[model samples]
Structures are given as structure tokens and as C-alpha cells.
Target: MPDTGRTMYARVVEHTCDDCVPVSYELCAAGGLMFIRWTDRTGGGKPVVRETERLISSRAREMWRDLLLGLVR
Candidate 1:
């Protein structure tokens, strides 16, 4: 069974640094909600994952674009 605490996102788009950076972000969506998942591997073992609060699909997409443009962190 699927985990009740975590909704399954059907799509995930990853944005990663080109220079072997250990950090990356993923745009994820489930039902009507969307959010960004941040992943870090700088700790040297076992990457850590964090997720932003859910947002409207459009807003999340915009945030993703802005992140690519270096507007938001």
C-alpha cells in the first residue's frame, strides 16, 4: 500500500547544477498540489531530502522557473 503520510507525485522534474554540485531540486506534483523537493549530498553520505509546502500548480511552476533564473532559493 502507498504510504498515507506521503502522497505520490506522478511527475518529477529535476534541476541540477552542471558542475558536479551535490545539491539539486525537483519539481513535484500530486493531484492539485505542487511543491519543490530539495536534495543535498554535501554531507558526504546519504543525501538528505526536504520538501517545500504544497502550492498551486501554476505558482509552483513559476517558482521553478524563477529558481532557474536565480530569482529564488
Candidate 2:
């Protein structure tokens, strides 16, 4: 297995609510490929949703960077 312990970048967005929910994004590399994961909680932590994608192309990596920048702004 590849070393999934390394993270290339990460971001967290906290919602302005009573619970102060947090959504997280992480970009990592494993098995010589890059992947992005998104994690969020639902129903007051009763359930969680996690989505991930493999970045197979430069265009996809660029789009991911753009999205991160947009979120920061």
C-alpha cells in the first residue's frame, strides 16, 4: 500500500451555526497518484459524508486549486 499518511494540502470550513459544524478537505498522494477528499457531518453527527476523487490530469489539479482559492476568497 502507498503511504496515505502524507497530505499535500488541507482546508477546513466551519459553518456559522449553533453546532459550529466543520467541513474538511484534504489532498493527498498515494501509489503515485493524487487524490482529494471531502468530509462533512450531517444530522448533528448522526451521519457523515465523505467524497473523494483521483486527480488524473493537470486540468483536474488546476481546477482543484482554483476551487480552493475560490473558497479562501
Candidate 3:
């Protein structure tokens, strides 16, 4: 999450359970591309944030749908 270029106005398209686990995932869109963001809140310390490479909305949505269907992890 150190990337200063990350969009501050990113729109979250979908997300996993919130406040119910130590980790969460979000499908986001910004600047005409989509990507997956993951956060880990383990060890009761600073959370670790990461993201997948940005892709076209259609392709990213397909991957997001597959993730929801348990077709991929």
C-alpha cells in the first residue's frame, strides 16, 4: 500500500466478510481498470495491504466471479 499512485477514489465493486475475520478481500475499480485488494490483520498489529495487477474490468470481473464461485483461490 506504499504506492503513492494508487487511486484515492477507488470504487469497491465487491468485498468479502468485514469485521468477521483477520483477512479480507475487495474488488476495486479505478482509472478504467480493476484489481483485487487484500488486507491481513493478523498479530493484532498493523495490517498488511496488497493488490493484484490491474486488468481490464471485464477480465477482472470474470476472475472476481470465479473467486466467488470457488473456482479459484
**How far off is residue 45 in model 2, in Å?**
1.8
> What number of clashing residue pairs does each candidate have, in the order they appear?
0, 0, 0
lDDT of 3 by residue, 1-73 (tens): 4434577788998999979999888999999999988888996898888888889999999988888888977
- Give the lDDT ranking, best first: 3, 1, 2
lDDT of 1 at 51: 79
Question: Looking at candidate 1, what is the lDDT of residue 9?
Answer: 49
The reply for model 3, stretches above 4 Å from the true place, is: 1-5
Show the lowest summed lDDT stretch of 10 residues, model 2.
Answer: 9-18
- lDDT per model vs. reference: 0.76, 0.49, 0.85
List model 2 lDDT by residue over 3-39, tens digit each: 2445544342221232455655555444455555554
Instruction: Using TM-score, rank the candidates from best to worst.
Output: 3, 1, 2
Alpha-carbon error at 67 in model 2, in Å?
1.6
lDDT for position 9 in model 2: 44
TM-scores for all candidates? 0.76, 0.48, 0.82
